[model samples]
Target: MSLTRSQVESIAHLARLDISEAELPVYADSLSKILSFVEQLSAADTSSVEPMAHPLDGESQRLRADEVSETDRHEKYQANAPSVTDALYLVPRVIE
Candidate 1:
């Protein structure tokens, strides 16, 4: 499929891109080729083919459960806060 100058310009406008008259022809050819490839791909037969996540063949790896727990140093951290009371950070209330 070949794309005309006007069609290419319209596509550029829709995509929010600016292309000069010279660049239009280059983009037109490239876009037309891509559209043609898509059309060809649509006509291909793949009824017996299975879909794959990746083109490269490899099995997913599993990791062992390493239980590492984290502790919060809230008291030490909140001690440096400008306004903190009873282990809670205080902020100015915006809702009136």
Candidate 2:
């Protein structure tokens, strides 16, 4: 699929990118090639393929045990705050 200069400009605007006149054609060609590659991938058959959670079978990701490791110091910390209510810090409202 070939992309025109105007399409490239629209893409740039949507992506919040600043593209110069000299780079517009280059970007358009590159984006067109990417879209073509995706189209080719879509044409491949994968009806028998099994979905995988991870590449390695029987190998699960290890995670640290969830446990409380610190003592509560809310009263000590709240003393330093300019304003706090019910263990929550109070901030000035900037919005109307």
Candidate 3:
């Protein structure tokens, strides 16, 4: 699980990061330790374990009614705006 200097450089490039020469060795060592720890975690026996959506058991996520309870007020709201066109608010062009 040891990472070389070149591997660290490649990883940095893929992640779009700018790593200095002095920081390369530090990143390489840290990444190597993280990969080694993940390897150790994968070796654990999970055959008897049951997969769960959450950590706690016998508890379901609370859900509210999916039906809409409010009436549409777009036109009412647009009346207060300075400018609106095609159901979209128009601000002064600032980029051009």
Candidate 4:
């Protein structure tokens, strides 16, 4: 799971990342350690574990009732438009 300096450079190129000569070895070591940790996690046993939608499955989420809190003011705002029709703003056509 360890990554080489050349592999890190290739990854940086594919991801469009700018890595200086001094930082390439640092990035390579960090990426190699991360891959090793992921490999270690993949070796765990989870066959008896049940899938869950939420961590707090017994608790119910309290939500506020959906209601209109603001009045419609389209007519007042449309008064400033240079051109409008049927509550819709008119714009110049750019394409044929």
List lDDT for all candidates, in order.
Answer: 0.87, 0.91, 0.92, 0.91
Q: Write model 4 residue lDDT over 1-96, tens digit each, in one string.
A: 889999999999999999999999999999998998888766779889887778798787777789888799999999999999999999999788
**Inter-residue clash pairs, candidate 2:** none
For TM-score, the strongest prediction is 3
Model 1 lDDT at residue 61: 54
Following a full C-alpha superposition, what root-mean-square deviation does model 4 have from the true structure? Answer: 9.6
TM-scores, one per candidate: 0.44, 0.46, 0.47, 0.45
Error of 4 at 24 (Å): 0.5
Q: Name the regions of candidate 2 deviating beyond 4 angstroms.
A: 45-96
| TM-score (C-alpha, index-matched) for candidate 4 | 0.45
Taking every candidate in turn, the Cα RMSD to the unseen true structure, in Å, is 11.1, 8.3, 8.4, 9.6
| Candidate 3, lDDT over the whole model | 0.92
Q: Give the Å shift of residue 38 in candidate 1.
A: 1.3
Q: On residues 25-76, what C-alpha lDDT tens digit does candidate 3 reach at each position?
A: 9999999999998897778799999776787676767788999988999999
Better of 2 and 3 by TM-score: 3
lDDT of 4: 0.91
